[model samples]
Target: MVIQKKVGFISVLFIISMHSWCQQQINLVDKFQNQKIKAVNRSITLYGDQRDAIELNAENSSGIGIIEDLEFEKGIIEIELLGENNPGKSFIGIAFNIQNNDTYEAVYFRPFNFVAEEQIRKEHMVQYIYHPEFTWRKLRSERTGIFEKGIRIPPDPEDWFKVSIHIKENNIEVYVNDLSEPSLIVDRLSSTKSKKIGVWSGYGSSGRFKNLIIK
Candidate 1:
């Protein structure tokens, strides 16, 4: 009888330990920004190669060499981006809604300089593209529902910026590092749920992304 009790106690302890470890792993996925990620590959091309970074050319096209496979039933996507290049008319940000191995949609931010004014403006923007269809549409000003226009979250050009995007059932929230509130929020989207995720760039921009986490 005593031997059975001892065995039962050991089993209980092992179960508790396993539960604790599982909880820790779940928390790690839930809060992805807090972990270190090694780069898997560079540029999602037919030939897979690992490079240090990616560059964007003209005609609004550039992509990270590395691709992460993630599914977001409902949660947040977070990343750290390091920006570079000059004469800055470029779009850089995270992407989702990838379909058919050839097309996807993205929400990107661009740095712009006004002709009349001397000030530089960072454009917080969103775009949807159905590739092969090659249809690209902007999701600012034209679309309604809680979108703040002309808001700038300045990029350091040399430092990493923590960008967090929260996607709930009916809302989207975007934020930069150390900011208590989101820089942009939209309460309504044509589709509130998505699974695919990626990094993107466009038109004369170069950048690096690291520490990507999706929950």
Candidate 2:
């Protein structure tokens, strides 16, 4: 699917197989029982890890493909993802309750800068972005030490990790790998009635997805 938006300066393109890819997507959609998936740019790869799984790579312009049938006003969203070990790039996470291509609250890990030797780079392991209005660039320039932070127990950025987002009415708690504690917590989130689930990656970043269970 091709999503055209006037905002957000980004996009994605599918590589690999088209026929086989369609078959795979069909199986996944059937398995999930939803057709609202915006797997544009042909970047979503699916598999079964004793269950269902998928991978998304941000190709051209900061790729973000939405899952249309899935919507969440308030709940916990869990995603298991693997990040490509690409250098000099940033991002890997979920954009939930998305209003469209230009609007959504995104929280992703800066794998490329996750465990840098430099103290400043290390502090950017975790980041939060509300697109269009609050891109990562603006967040860093305007609100330093507010939207992003380093992980207390840092994991290998390139390796697979599970991120759980606990969303309440106005609050959010982000837990990575560990469910007992949150790596970052926000007292407030941007307001929206969006129910879309997007597999998001920064421009040129690659991410894999699987076992998405909302509770």
Candidate 3:
């Protein structure tokens, strides 16, 4: 019908737009720049946060704080981070293609749980999450082993360790300390595509991060 043809044309245009976006050259990783970000939590402040380094003070509250900027689709995102033992819920990582802090794909680490005596807690070390919809809770409940898995190699969970995340199309590979192999890999990104990039932390969790490079 006529309506069907119009819909098809619109879809084609959208696809073309996305293709152009993907090809657009951006060089944020070349230098550490103080870029602007839309924080998911207004209560959490980043007044002293820096481009080469960032320390978040959650003020003893729990919630996801994200940076809604970067508009990164695919490439490598690497950073060195140290999660504080106090305020103690360590869910630190990067949230990409962030529609918002509440809506995005994030691969975070639960350092406290990394070396827990219990296997269940150990299994919670590294995770892939889709906010507001499929959290680590829902992913554990329904998808089970698909979205989250244990880390075989444990770096000083509380100390600074480098993490490198490589994204290509719908696939994402997470590299912890060791870059030779991925600690976790996701076969699918979002149908919406990943555009935004930011360091994220759970509520009450404070962290120190540096050397963020994206190419």
- TM-score attained by model 3: 0.73
The 0-to-1 C-alpha lDDT of every candidate, in the order given, reads: 0.50, 0.70, 0.68
TM agreement with the true structure for every prediction? 0.58, 0.77, 0.73
Off by over 4 Å in 2: 1-36, 40-42, 47-52
**Which candidate should be chosen as best, given lDDT against the real structure?**
2
Count clashing residue pairs per candidate. 3, 4, 7
lDDT per residue for candidate 2 within 82-157, as digits (tens), equals 7754565656788877886767888888777656889988778778888778887898899887778878777777
Candidates ranked, most accurate by TM-score first: 2, 3, 1
Sum up the clashes in candidate 2: 4
Give candidate 1 regions above 4 Å deviation. Answer: 1-68, 101-103, 111-153, 192-194
| Candidate 1 C-alpha lDDT tens digits along 54-172 | 33333444453224344554567787765543445555677666552445545566533211133313333333333434333333334432343333545454556678877676667
Better of 1 and 3 by TM-score: 3
Ranking of predictions according to lDDT: 2, 3, 1
Cα error of candidate 3 at position 106, Å: 0.6
